[model samples]
Target chain A: MKRIEKVADMAKTSRILAAEGKSIGFVPTMGYLHDGHLALVREAGKENDVVIMSIFVNPAQFGPGEDFESYPRDLERDAALAEKAGVDILFHPSPEEMYPEESDIRILPGRQADVLCGASRPGHFDGVLKVLTKLFHLTRPERAYFGQKDAQQLAIIETFVRNYNFPLEIRRVATVREEDGLAKSSRNVRLTPEERKEAPAIYAALKDGARMLRESGDPELVLGMVRNSLGRIPDAEADYAEILDYPSLRPLSAESGEAIIAAAVRFSGARLIDNILVPLEGKTS
Target chain B: MKRIEKVADMAKTSRILAAEGKSIGFVPTMGYLHDGHLALVREAGKENDVVIMSIFVNPAQFGPGEDFESYPRDLERDAALAEKAGVDILFHPSPEEMYPEESDIRILPGRQADVLCGASRPGHFDGVLKVLTKLFHLTRPERAYFGQKDAQQLAIIETFVRNYNFPLEIRRVATVREEDGLAKSSRNVRLTPEERKEAPAIYAALKDGARMLRESGDPELVLGMVRNSLGRIPDAEADYAEILDYPSLRPLSAESGEAIIAAAVRFSGARLIDNILVPLEGKTS
Candidate 1:
């Protein structure tokens, strides 16, 4: 595997590979790689001739008082894991290299960014869109991979690509999870042993809530049930729990074809989020 | 020239040509086939293997009370002229095709858009950025061409591409003009015979102001002279006349490297604009 730190060199390398008719699958992550990130890379490796993974702990996506300073980063460890995960190119750019100059321009998110984690974290997805815009322009991949773990981000980015008519595909990989149903995340390591034991409840609640939503087709009832289920965890504060139309992230209606059961829980040391996409029993997704 | 009206077809055609190692030069314009539009196509033809010209009277760029309702469009005539200018592909998409769904997402401009024409037409460059985002994605050309006639738009777009790290290049084509020095514009056709006779003064004022700016190194003095020159035309109104730092479109200072002298004039039925890019004498541009 090859490692690149310069922005211009990565862009040139990707363009050269593209000119040679090689399909590139790009996976953009915020370093401190875990099984979730490697899962995306492995999927990219299976689908394209070259898999390019970018590790950028983008500061733009972090709001004031957010975990920007505490974000985990280990380049040496990440590089070794990425090589083992079949990544062909590793793009690790510093903050200065990614944002050389300050300009007021921004890629604002649409309606899809208003729900789930976005409700509590304002301007978060805008930062995500900004970084993706730069990364996509540099990579110019045939297909870009995203794990369902950050489902709101995946949906917003998919909408951006579709609305902007970007000539590439968004391939979504399923969220990697532990055998006990806890979502694989870099923050998972920060959980105390007791918090780790209770973390599995988040995914279990989503699973049960999706089933309830499919049967009742009532957003309010399913959401309340999810909140009640999350309330069972000791000292685990539910940041947000809601049901909305799948990718649009709008209010659910009778005509809605699909929905998402998503929740974010704040523990002592880390915050965890999980979601499940549900196709209505009688409606097409 | 091959004409494509559907958005998907144009994107696919461009991508196929790109995959074949063809460097595309894209020229986007609102069509009435003036020499100015053809000049951009001619420049695109010379620079790449395939020249793609899009004739879209983008409503996104026109604000309320603007000329969107009466903007000139002549597809058959434009197609003939584009072919004569050696354009390989001509893309003409309707407003509905371009914006199929309502999306609030926008690519907002920076300080570069807050001056000159943007001052009078609020949210104009936001629309410009929106459409250009879609157009640039669909037609991922090696280099995109713009006329210096709309110096503010060119500067804002150049900044957008640079700040976003878009892989494509921005090539500035010199403003195409008539023998009497009137900048070529579709709106010029609306000018009465008498108005036509006096229109050359717009460019004349810009040329004189550029020299004044260089000699005096004072923006206010040069802009006052431009306004005074435009005031000489009987029954005409000076919409705007100003000089500012080039590209960045910021306030001028002792450290400024280059500048632009731009003006817009309103006739009885038509509005015209022109500009001159001036490199400050002891500075590297």
Candidate 2:
């Protein structure tokens, strides 16, 4: 597998691929690959002639108090896993290489980014959109793969592509999970042994909430059940448990067509997030 | 020449061109054609296998009270002029087609857009950047052309492409002017006969200002000369006459490397803008 470190070199490679009419499928990620990231790469491999994976722990996406400095990264391990997963190219660029100077332009995400995780962490989606813009331009992939684990992010990116008329498709793979149903995340490594034990409850809460949302039409009752599920786990604090319309992430009404039950919980040293998309009556995808 | 009125058709055409390994040079403009717009198309024709010109008078770039409603458009004339200039395709999308819904995402231009014309027309460059982002992605040109007449717009776009690593070159064609030295602009039609006669003073002021800047290193003196030159014209109200550093558009000092003398003048019925770039003692491009 070819490894590229410079943006210019990446663009050159993509152009050469374009000339040969090779369909590139890109998987952009921060290093410390988990099954979730590998799942994206695997899907990309199945769908395209070439698979390109980018591992850059983008600093712009992290806030000043966030884990920008301490984000997990292991290039050697990530490279081996990516190669095993059939990635043709691994783009690992330095922070300076990705952003040589402060950006004079930024992507301002719309109202969809104002709820759930966005409320807790402001400007996070903006950073995600910005970096993705750069990566999409550099890679020029026929299709880009993103995990449904970051559901809001996937929605925002999907909206950005549609709104800007980007000539590419965004393929969303289901979230990869541990046997216990906990969504796989790079931040999962930061969980202490006790915190790890409690992490599964976050997903359990989301699942129960989804079930409640399907059964009962009352959003408040569903939210209460979700909060109660998280409350049962000692030291697990619910950050947010929201029943919002899918994709748009707006507050869900009884008549809302489709819904997503999403939750974020704080477990001592780590923050975990999970969600389930609930198909409304007579509607399924 | 093929005329496309839909974004989907335009994207398909660009993709077909890409598959055939044909280089596309794009010229994006408002519908009212002038020599300046033709010059960009002419340059694009010379440099690529296909030249695509898009005539879109973007509403997003105009303020509420601005001339968006009154923005002059002559599609028949523009189409004829573009065909004569060797344009391969003319994309004329309606505002509703360009923006089916209010954009959920937008590009917020940075400090470079906060001065000169930007100060008077808030969110102007933001709108420009947003439309260009959509157009650039849809057209997927190997090279895009812009006139140096809108120097700040050209500079901001160059920075946008650079920052995003867009896989295309931005070719800045020199400003095309009439024999009387007035820069060719679609807005030039709004000028009365008497106002049109005095419109050349805007360029004259810039030229005289550039000469003054080259002779004397003092920015204040150069700016005064420009303002005074514009003041001598009857019914001409100087909107802004300032000497600022080029590209950065910051306050100029003796140590500033490259500089621009930009001015906006308001006539009885029309507003005109012009600028001149001056390379300092040890710098030349």
Candidate 3:
């Protein structure tokens, strides 16, 4: 696989491929590739003539107290995994290369960004949108792959693309998980031994909440069950457990068409989040 | 020239051209074409394989009391002028067509937007940037053209394109003017006969300011001369007359290498703005 380290070279390469009528599928990621990231690359390879995976741990997306400095990265290991997963190109750019100067323009995400993860982490989605805007323009992919594990991010990206009229499709792959139902995440390794063992409850609570959403009509009841499920865990502290309408991320009413049961739990040193989409009575995905 | 009225059709047409390796040059304007608009179209025609002129009186750019409702528009006249100027396509989308819903994402322009015309028309640059973002994505131009008559807008756009890493060049066309030296503007027609007679003084003041900048190094002195020059016009009310550094639009200093003299003056019912770029000792444009 060809590895590109410069923005200009990547843009030129993508332009040449575009001129030749080749559809490019891109999977943008921060390094330390896992099965979840590889799953996106595999899906991209199946759909497009060229598949590119970018590894840049963007500092813009991290707040002051966030683990930007300690974010896991292993370039050589990621390169090997990406190559084995059938990635045609690997774009690895240094922070200096990606951002030569501070950005003058700042993107403010809409109302959807004011709740859940957005409420706790201010300017997070704005940074995500900013980096994605740069990456999208640089790569100009025909389709971009994103894992559903970051569902709020996925929804915001979809809205941004639709609102901005970016000529690309956002293909969402399902969240890859472990045998114990815990969602696979880069932060998983940061968990202490005890925290790691108890982290599965985060996803378990989300699953139970999804079932409650499907069977019951009351949003508050569903949320209470979710909070109670997380409360049962020995050392788990619920950060936010709520049921909101999908995509819009607005408060869910009894008549709300579709919903997402999402929760974030704090355990010792690690913070874990999980979500499940529940289609309403007659709806099917 | 082919006229497109729908956003989807324009995007599809542009995509087909892109796939055929054709470079598109775009000129985005609020309708009621003048010599200034035609000059941009002409320049775009010279540089690109396909030239597209989009006439959209973007409501997003106008404040509540602004002339958005009374903004001059003559589709038939514009279409004729565009065809005579060798435009390959004319995209005339309705306000509803451009913005089906209130935008979820609103672009906040940087520091450059807080002065000059931006001070009088709040949120104007934000609206301009927002519409341009949408149009740039939909049209996917190789280069976009803008006249220097709106120098502040041009400066902000240049900074925005640079900051966001947009994949296109901004080709600036010299401000086209009437024989008597009044910069051509669609708003010029709104001036009363007496107001129109005094309007050329705006440009005359800018020219004098440019000369003062070349001869003297003091920005405050140059601005005082510019304001006095406009002050001489019978019914003119000088809105703002200042000298600032080029591109950055920051306050100018003796050490500042290049500069721009910009002013906005209200004459009866019309508001007219003009500017001149001054290159330092060894620099030439």
Candidate 4:
């Protein structure tokens, strides 16, 4: 349960761990720890000799109009939760520490980044990739843990690791949700009471679409139904609703191996996104 | 010397080397194996327990009209030279091995990469930085060496390592030269017989500019003298001849610590460049 700030300090600590033949498992987060983040920490604790969780609410990832200033941060609470989850180290660096100098270098995705979240928030994934790259270099983890809640992010990270030939393994944890089917997110606290009431509709739409896709072999029809369901929610503005191939984020023609029914909707000025994978119906082991 | 082509092989080798507590020294070169590259290898061999050299004629660094296809390469000769220089490994990866998938991630330098060779070759430094970044990640060298002949390239790599917080040390090997003062380069093989005869003028002009700056501390006056000196060579066409800050490469005005007389000249359709640093006269040790 040690806390560190400087990049050099963290790198030195990680190097010692690596020198001792200990495999490091890392979970990079933007603080405001929820069960989802804790899930990743727990997974890392199980898999590696040492687990590190970095809390950096990276300014690079937020778009100009996005809620960067209002992004939730609770370092003390996060540290306690991470310690409970058996994290060995908490890397909590300030923005100035994380980005000592402005970077013009960016990591952009191929066709995958041009659609969905990328289109909605330009330069967002580039920022994400940039911080992830820096953290990866600093940590040099044997395995890195990421939650499936950020499914597209996980996919892009996997692509980045493969494409860059990064010497690390990536482990994706399942999306942690609340009893109300709401995905655990720091931004969830920003939702107004009315917005909170309507927020679950986004997830409901995804669930409905995935169930329909599993029952019927029509992707377009299921997507349309999800759109219509989201459209009917009070003040809920659907950014996009599509059933896409797992990981690639490419739009799928029909229900293939494991298709993702993903959607982003704006409710009371807060953009909420959710997704559920529709498992292949007749492929039980 | 052991030669590895695949990134996986290099990573495996690096892991074993790390386990043995051996420091890896890396020299990344576009093979034509001249004295300049060997100088770097010699430096690496002296400083590190394990010396690794990569001979990749990166296609990404060449512009549309540049000599990418004709970039001289002789792996057998390079392997022998590396072995002679006591290199432990020579990584000779194919373009496919390095770039298995097309790269959309570009490492754009903020201030350093947009001038000189960068201006002449768009997306050139992005390619250079990307490939070098990949190499750094794969090799995880204790220190990496680059010749000061490509001053701009050296500056870019320095800035990258600092900004990205890469753990490797950077060593700038002094520029190696031919007997006639021509900077040693693989591209020197591409020069026609007449071009070869006139290539010395590039260095001559640089030396003249350095002499002028040392004798008289006026950058403008030094530049004029160098320009006129290059103008004397009948076959040589001056591209840019200016006195600037040694490391930053910004145009100089007042007396500075170390100033460079950097110039690029086109001789017989082959662009040649050279620079010499002049410590300000009367500066105390």
Q: Identify the leading candidate in terms of DockQ.
A: 2
- How displaced is residue A70 in candidate 3, in Å? 0.4
For model 3, name the residue pairs that clash: none
Candidate 1, A67-120: lDDT as tens digits? 888888899999999999999999999999999999789888967877778889
Residue-wise C-alpha lDDT for candidate 1, range B1-285, written one tens digit per residue: 898999999988877876787889999988898898888888888889999998898988898888998877788988999998899999999999999988888887877777788888999999999999899988889999999998899988888998888889999999999999999999988889999999998888888988877788777888888999999988589988888888778887666788888888999877889989888877754
Cα misplacement distance, residue A157 of candidate 2 (Å): 0.8
Q: What is the RMSD of candidate 1?
A: 1.5
Return the candidate ranking by lDDT, descending.
Answer: 1, 2, 3, 4
**Cα RMSD for candidates in order:** 1.5, 1.4, 1.7, 2.6
Global lDDT of each model? 0.89, 0.89, 0.88, 0.83
Model 3 / residue A113 / CA error / Å: 0.3
Return the lDDT, model 4, position A243: 76
Question: Interface RMSD for each candidate model?
Answer: 1.1, 1.0, 1.2, 1.9
Q: Which CAPRI category fits model 3?
A: medium
- For model 4 the local lDDT of residue B109 reads 68
Worst 10 residues of 4 chain B by lDDT: B247-256
Candidate 2's docking class is medium
Candidate 2 ranges beyond 4 A from true positions: A282-285
Model 2 residue A146 lDDT score: 91
Model 4 lDDT tens row, B30-83: 887988888998899888999999989999888888878877789999899889
